[model samples]
Target: MASARLERGVVVGARLLVAAVFVAAAVPKILDPAGFAAAIRNYQAFPYWSWNGLAVGVPMLEVVGALALLSGWKRQAGALLLGGLTLAFVALITSVIVRGIDIGCGCFGQSEAAESVGWPLLVRDLGLLAAIVVAAREPGPLRAARVR
Candidate 1:
């Protein structure tokens, strides 16, 4: 019973942590989309026409996924979306590093002092992916022990 209780606590913690991250990342972008759009443009990954669409959509997606994670019934779906987004971020960051395009990662918003994409950011995103995975998979119900 104690173990099961601990597991439940950990899972809930993971979900809250992941949701918090998404909300933090989403808010700045949601407020200042044009700057975020410029940050997307700096990536040079997507076409010029798509930048505006991505700028608008990505923050909304983050908020929606975060909300879902907060809702017990929709947690799995939320985790899946957040996990996929994290993976995509990892890939995108890796691509930037490989191509040697040094620029601030437009993750939290288009701040002048934003951190640049590098191995550190990739590792962070990977950590987030792991947390998302944990949040998505809740432990099975505990069974009672029987004695002879």
Candidate 2:
């Protein structure tokens, strides 16, 4: 019984953490789309035509997924979506490092001095990815206890 409670607590905690990250990331992007677009352009990962669309779309997706996670109605789907987003971010950041392009992470809103891309960012994304995966895989508290 205690183990089941603990598992539920952990899952809930992970969900909240992931949701908070998405909300934090989305708010800045939503508030300053132009700045986010500029940062995306700096990545040079996408074509010029796609920048505007991506800048708008990504944040909206984050907001929706975050809300879903919080609501628990589509938590698994949200976890999958956010996990994919984190993976894409990790890939993009890694590419920036490999290509030796120095640019702001664009994770938050525009800043006079944007945080540069580096391993730290990659590690952070990876950690988020791990959390998402763990949450996704974890059965609900009742189900988990039954399986064990």
| Positional deviation of residue 15's Cα in model 1 after best superposition, in angstroms | 0.5
lDDT of 2 by residue, 43-123 (tens): 998999999999999999899988887787787898888888888999999999999998889997787776899999999
Q: Candidate 1: where is the Cα deviation over 4 Å?
A: 142-148
TM-score of 1: 0.92
How large an RMSD does model 1 have?
2.9
Candidate 1 local lDDT, 1-148, one digit each (tens): 6787677778889989999999999999999999899999998899999999999999998998988987876878888888888988998999999999999998999887899999999999999999888888766644332221
Residue pairs whose backbone atoms clash in candidate 2: none
| Model 1 residue 61 distance off true place after TM-score fit, in angstroms | 0.7
lDDT of 2: 0.88
Model 2: weakest 10-residue lDDT segment is 136-145
Worst 10 residues of 1 by lDDT: 139-148
Off by over 4 Å in 2: 143-148
